[model samples]
Target: MTVYIDDAVHPWRDQRWAHLMADTLPELHAMAAQLGIPRRAFQNRRSGAHYDVPAPMRERAIALGARAISRHTDRELLKAVIANARLQYDATA
Candidate 1:
């Protein structure tokens, strides 16, 4: 039941982005609210439920207590988190 953010390395629109995820949808939205992120940013996709956070915001999210996970170094843990995120969408849809 923890909030997690991955490294801001995904590139798009001239900016690097990160994925913000949590063990549950409520926790994810709560943390995003704390980070001043709008709920409209939530990406409820088949891949996973997450918010695409920009690089600068990613750092702020980490400072605000989001655990950082890396695709390169924390593969197993990150996979588990993604699995949890997917369940969030599946439960509702």
Candidate 2:
């Protein structure tokens, strides 16, 4: 299960943040845990679970096997994430 973070870089609330996502929620959680991110920090997005990871955490996540996305902006990334969620949701239907 590969994990991808949207945006090569982003700024949020004074500091930069990146959108982190995975093919599955469990995969996402496992990667986040490896990066020492607390479970409470998980961001509950309509497109699976996401987390606005700081730059440092983003880098660490990448180093630990998460893929860093650089081609799309936040909106585009969000669209993809949502699509993935819809697919997952539909498969269960």
Candidate 3:
């Protein structure tokens, strides 16, 4: 499974944030662990299941083997990743 980190363009708290997702929930959690992110930070909402990562964390995630995706350049694949993430949550919830 592949872990994906989108461009950190969501602005909040004076810093940009991005979504950290994976092909499956387990993979997603594992990557989050590697990134030193707590499980409590997981966002399991209906919008999509993912972790909100900071801009700096985006580089770390990429270094740790996450595939970086840009919302402007990779719209279609990003949508698929998001759909898969939501499916994982839906199946278990």
Candidate 4:
């Protein structure tokens, strides 16, 4: 079980953001709590269960032990992580 933060740095509302996902919902929520992100901020979409972390917080997540994954470089692992996240969402839903 591991937490993954992607390098998808998309810009929104003038801040860059990335997706924070984990092998399980509990792990995902725990990391979000550690980052001071409220449970309400969790994105529970069918796309994938995740927390959107801003650019600066992305670095903090890495420092706190979240595995950094790049869509460009970690295609397979990223897919597996996302698949697991979607499964987690389905289980809870």
Candidate 5:
């Protein structure tokens, strides 16, 4: 299973953020934990299960072995990951 971090381009609270996703929830949560993010931070919505990480934390996630994906250059892979995440959310819900 793979963990993926997208480009940290979403602006919020005076900082840029990114989405952290994975092939499985366990992997996703594990990566978030490794990045010092709390379990309560997990987003389990229909849009897709993910963790919102700041730009700096996004870089750390990449260094910790999460694959970096771009919405601009990695459209297809991003689609698949999001689909899987949605499915995960549905299963849990």
Candidate 6:
């Protein structure tokens, strides 16, 4: 399973940001812990577990071996089309 952390180039407060997520919740949580991210940031969604990380933590996360991915379209890359599409459908309906 691959872990993805796309740099959040957007501005918010005194730092930049990023998103730490994975194909599975367990993997996502594990990576978050490795990156020193607190458990309070976990966001459970139809896609997966996501954490909005700040600039400092983003670098730390990268140092901890978090693979940086593109924030755009990267979310879709995690889930197979069939599964994700189905999930989206279920969510909408």
Task: Give the top-scoring candidate (TM-score).
Answer: 5
User: lDDT score of model 6?
Assistant: 0.65
Between candidates 2 and 5, the TM-score winner: 5
**Top lDDT prediction, candidate number:** 5
Task: Arrange candidates by TM-score, descending.
Answer: 5, 4, 3, 1, 2, 6
lDDT of 2 by residue, 24-81 (tens): 8788889888888899888774455576788767778888888777654456766776
Tens-place lDDT per residue, model 3, 14-85, is 999999989988999999999999999989977778999999989999999999999999999999998988
Off by over 4 Å in 6: 45-48, 71-93
Q: What is the lDDT of residue 44 in candidate 4?
A: 91
The segments of candidate 4 whose C-alpha lies over 4 angstroms from its true place after superposition are 91-93
- In candidate 6, what are the lDDT values of residues 58-87, reduced to their tens digit? 777777777776645665664442253234
CA shift of 37, model 4, Å: 0.4
What alpha-carbon RMSD in Å does predicted model 1 have with respect to the real structure?
1.4
Q: Taking the tens digit of each residue's C-alpha lDDT, what string does model 5 give over 1-93?
A: 899999999999999999999999999999999999999999998889999999989879999999999999999999999999888885545
lDDT (0 to 1) per candidate: 0.91, 0.73, 0.92, 0.92, 0.94, 0.65
For residues 1-93, write the lDDT of model 4, one tens digit per residue: 889999957999999999999988899999999999999999998889999999999999999889999999999999999998887676455
Candidate 1: count of backbone clashes, pairs at least 3 residues apart or interchain: 0
lDDT of 1 at 91: 43
- For model 6, how many clashes? 0
Model 3: residue 9 alpha-carbon error in angstroms? 0.6
lDDT of 6 at 41: 73
